[model samples]
Target: MHDSHNSTAARLFETEGTGNPLDVLKRVYGYSAFRGKQQDVVEHVVAGGDAVVLFPTGAGKSLCFQVPALCRNGVGIVVSPLIALMRDQVEALKQLGVRAAALNSSLTRDEAIAVRHSLAAGALDLLYVTPERAVTDAFADMVADTDIALFAIDEAHCVSQWGHDFRPEYRGLGCLASRFPGVPRIALTATADPHTRDDIIKRLGLDRARVFTTSFDRPNIAYEIVERDQPRQQLLRFLSRFKDASGIVYCLSRAKVDDTAEWLNTQGIRALPYHAGMDRALRDAHQDAFLKEERLCLVATVAFGMGIDKPDVRYVAHLDLPGSVEAYYQETGRAGRDGLPSEVWMAYGMADVIQRRRMIDEGGSPEEIKRIERGKLNTLLAICETAGCRRQAILAHFGEAHPGRCGHCDTCLKPVETWDGTEAAIKALAAVYRTGERFGAGHVIDVLMGTINEKTERFGHVDMPVFGAGKDLPPRTWQSVFRQLLAAGLIKVDHSAFGALQLEPEARSVFRRERQVLFRKDRPSSGKAARGTKSATARERSDLAGSDLELFEKLRSQRLAIARDMDVPPYVVFPDTTLIALAKQRPRGFEDLLDVPGIGESKREKYGEAFLAVIDAFEEGGG
Candidate 1:
């Protein structure tokens, strides 16, 4: 490509004509209709307007901007923070018969040159780049003169400095508004509270854009919170239900992630560890395998997942408490993005609560920021302790209303029993206060139970008036009371005392007996994994039956082989959803296979025959 090629490419988007988004949706992406507010956002952008979209994780936010880019001319530049996701996104789009490419550190010199040539020649329909690279002068200089159909900033919540996953590079996106004046831009995020939403708009310079907030609910994702009791064993039990499916297990620290992944590997599971502490190349390799391999589990820290668009991630388990409800929602939201049945299993415990509280309180952030973080943590804690529907609590936190109790969460699956914890709470609060609030939950618990150990005697807490008062109750029961009290805002961690238990003003009510306290005993629990039942409409698949499951495994192997040959993720060739559909229907021939979801004209023509051959052999008793 020469210098003149830039101007020639610029003219590509200046065409006076455009196409219908709905037509592009069917002919290109293989989808029949837009879901939720996608149509509105797409139509708005197609008409040369700007917008901000807040669709849930699995709600198909990419379509809102991707379709408009195709309807018009020129390349669509998608700005995202997750470099790992760029490969998967570009590969998936390429399978859709679209000319998509990515320019990032992952590419070799030759591959980068090829992508640059395609972009300069106006051959690429979509170009994905991270914000750090997107704002660079070299990239901006190259594309400055070229015509851009649109800019889609994925996970736009990163613009919020207070967001759970803040990337400083995301702040540079405001330059897009100034740099690409007339080009339509859509800032999209899956998790953003009202304040964060407004901050994204202002920070991204999208004040003039239309705002579309879809419902923040993933009905197909069952929410299950298990109290941490033998976490590794509990995780084993959770994985048993989702055998041979891809999923992610999130940990709080790098050490834990390393240990857990190694432990899982020893248990006869092919697990990988990804964290910031690992070698960069090794981390990228692990992430790549997770996207490309079937039934691979990635045990990672929050650093691992942000924009992973893998459709068949059937479950996400958390071994530790998340910093905020927003973090938990966004992380768990990674699963079941394809609208298939999925589950989010978390093993929470008193340690998690205490650790999270201490982290928030003693964090290096300013007091004001810490205060807000504490509030978010409490919201998440409430969900873990709620006897009511978990979905309702999550949605309510997002300013959405769901009156009916959702039957998906653990509380809804097995109704929790609430006890009158007022007396227990009062005793616990008194114990914390009598101990001078200089210790953490563990020590306070020991004092309250009259377990006169070295710590109790060393701290001179044995003679405290509230010492033996709660001895009638078991230590486990008292531990639950302390957790509930902490979650209820009646007690907080004292950063000054190095995470000592401290009473809040709300605790005064317990002494006066002015307020009632109710606590739901959170015990170890698990969820029923939606074994993928086949149906045409949902286009869904998961945990299939006897024969169908065997056939699905064969199809997956075939897909994996094809993906390896193509140098793309297995999902790029065919998502598990589509594979399961093929197995259940046992498509007779090429034409019959086209009826499956994600099987479009381009994909059908490119990969259909080989798949149909396998199906034909399986059906004809050629086993």
Candidate 2:
């Protein structure tokens, strides 16, 4: 199969206009045209110009470099940060019949030698390496001796200190500009705010590169955030909709990841835990299983998803709040990378806010960095508390303007209720002040509700003027008020005093009755609402019905079988989008199969007959 695919690739390059990107796009990758700025970026790089691409997760960022590499001379050098990411991309590229290889610590000695030999012989089209390896003197000398193409930097945001996933090794990549002066370089990432973007450009020395910024909106992903009430039950309710699909559940701690995975298993959901604290071998094994299995959930920390190439992830749920908007965007963007409709759900509460703020305040970052991080955290909180379009708030954080009411997020689907929260805000702030500003929300709420708890009694006689000040409202309503106040910057958490609630400078206006506060009325937790109203598979195959849906399942089974035989992920055989096309079109032969969106010449020549047999069997009543 490998040889046949490689021969097909060779034949493609042997044809007329071999170096033309459009021709390559059609014949090699099986896409008829470029989407958005892909064509322009490809053309610029093919013509020996540097570029920086800021396309979203599923927006064909890989093709912007892969197509240009195929069109230009010599081998393209790709600098990747993760071994798993490099391995996945290399396998995917090879499945397309492109000769690709990666040099990382995971390789055996002989395998490393073979890759080096392949590079020296100019037999590889693209070579992926880590920044640590790429900056070494030995690797630099080896590249100096070889015919070089443009340098493609993946996850270029890692070079920026302001980026959420910064890596110190990426700082060494700045030398690439001086060492390889004439080579065109393209730095690509799916997540970067204005600060991170400028830092990437400056640090990677891409000051002169063409910067292409695409819209950050992932309309296919429906965003939903709920107030944390029985969070495990909330997650389970959300998971019930995607029982037979692959997804990720992110937690804030290693213990939570383990407990969640174990509990999910007891609930009959196939789940595995992943965190940096896990054994390296076990972590790798869990990650490998996640990439290969179809109906599994990986309960993990932020460590598991930096460059995951899996395209069929149906959902990403967060049991706790992320640190910032950028972190939230990047993690949730992992879902529905194939551009099919997906969902991102998060459950958070007042405790999550206090914990996150505590983490930030207790960290050793410089004061300036901590201030910026706090501001970022506040922006994310605002998004969660907003009653308007969640998508609009998310995009606005990235400096992209989306017309409000995206119609897909939870807010647009079911608008939230708001109430005049000014009086409630003042009472909440006064409770904190009357408690000496040294107590957390729970203690303050106790004092407000006139609950004679032991600690409150010890702190005071329970005779303060603000005691029983908020007895009219329920505790849950007061929780919402405090959470929103913290989010709105009207109140702050004092980590040094152990998560104590304190009034911010802005609270003075609210106390003076000069500022009116509004808050989203907290909705009661409903399991049915948590499990969305829309059918789980509706967006991916809304057009397929009856036999077409059956045929899609059959096609997926066949792809999985072939992938298992070749020891590759199922998507590497063919993505679900392609399988849906095949199931709908029921292409009869190689010519018709080539017309499918994802079938290149190599795939057509290699796996075309197997898929065609499936369709034929379905038509003959053997499916």
Candidate 3:
């Protein structure tokens, strides 16, 4: 570690204050051009201006601050949210020959002292610390004595109370503006609704900073949702499509995460469980395994995936509904970070809606905050129920306008069937009303289906006129009706009354026949047909076939070997996208390999000979 740090310091000394972002980008990171608002943000920060970047995941947000930090006079201070995230980025930077270090609790005393000595001596390019550590008086005093380049706040949305992953410590970051008046500050995040965005700006004192917001659409990801029928079986079918690929399966509870992981293992899948309740050492071990292993699934609750930097996650599956569109977007954004074709799949049902609502209502939050949270949940429900493109709905939630028919989501690939269910909705509401609106969906559904169960008999609901009204329809169909009604705001789950179905004011118009209700027709629960006929993995590498595919796999094997030798994630060496480029181009020399997108001077000098040897051997054996 000391030798590598000294080498990194020497490299920094050679290139310090180059003052050209593009030069730094090519010579250090190996990308030719700047992506979507990156150039604007980089140039602004390099010119000593503050910025707030709101780009989606995989949009290259790090380069915005990183390039400027290299082109500036002093070391960049990055405020990160998680230790794992900081460590991953620091390791990747080191691989790029950049002098980077992290100050977090994970470091040993000796290691922390080494980092501090490097920072004091101006031998570091970037330093990552958590918000809790950054706000300390001792750390601030230490920074006061160092030559500070800029302050970059990653995951800036955590500063907002309205944000899905808010942390109170982030609020203290507002002091950086006053404490270091001239040092440029940049706040970056991938997910923030309009309300949260405003809150972040106000809280961070970045009102005067230029804001760069790119489209919220992740076009490479295919979104698919289905009704939760035999959820474990449905998940199995989904997993069958993505065989041996890396992904995440999010459950709503710790017990569910453990049970689902155990079940998946029994079904012959490599699975692990992660949650806050697990022992700390075991949790870290599981997380480390997920990061290092190539084809394993980490089944976890929302406690996972906040700051995960693994770029090759092929999919993100939700066994239950997420709390809000923000939460859903952030979690699903963890996939396809390489800009390759990936998938986001979810299975939801009426029970999920009830559970989510109950959790929100039973929590200790202010009334206003609770109201905002409910609204956010409703927006997510709208996305699940929408017959239009799911991407369009998601973008609209972020106040971005995207034309419908993205052609990547489930609705565009295979349009959902819809039916005019005004009559069914009225009957369902009538059942709720006739049952005194104090009974849960099960009792109300039983009354509607004309099922003479003990609860129905005990409540004397069999004598009601609404009883047997929906006898012709299957129980599942009625459940769809009730679920859609709740989603449509015609009815809601009254958690205080033990998940009773209560009609909203809008239900009156539907009962009066003044407004019609349309429900998305529930498809058969055959997970094989859940997504379209095409498999995502096949589509991901459609350009490569036969020998090219073989070469790609060989390159992956080589990358895994090198990564294992270095004790780093495979992507820290080279992302799959770079390997794909290498396979297609088949560069035979170091000069030609440098033409690859992700090959920089450092990587070309380090791994060039090994990769070329593989290519040479492959060509020698071929026609």
Report the error of model 1 at residue 438, Å.
Answer: 1.5
Q: lDDT tens digits, residues 407-485, model 3?
A: 8888888899999998988899899888888988888888988999888899898998999999888999988888888
Higher-ranked by TM-score: 1 or 2: 2
lDDT of 2: 0.89
For residue 47, what is the lDDT in candidate 1? Answer: 90
Question: By summed lDDT, which 10 consecutive residues of candidate 2 come out lowest?
Answer: 1-10
Worst 10 residues of 3 by lDDT: 1-10
Any idea what lDDT model 3 has?
0.89
The residue-level lDDT of candidate 3 at 611 comes to: 84
- Model 1 bad stretches (over 4 Å): 1-17, 108-110, 524-554, 583-595, 619-623
Candidate 3: where is the Cα deviation over 4 Å? 1-15, 532-535
Task: Please provide, for model 1 over 331-384, each residue's C-alpha lDDT reduced to its tens digit, 9 standing for 90 to 100.
Answer: 999998878888888888877877787787767788888888989998898888
TM-scores for the candidates: 0.91, 0.96, 0.96
For model 2, residues 385-431, the per-residue Cα lDDT tens digits are: 99999999999988899998888888888899999989889889988
RMSD of each: 5.5, 2.4, 2.9
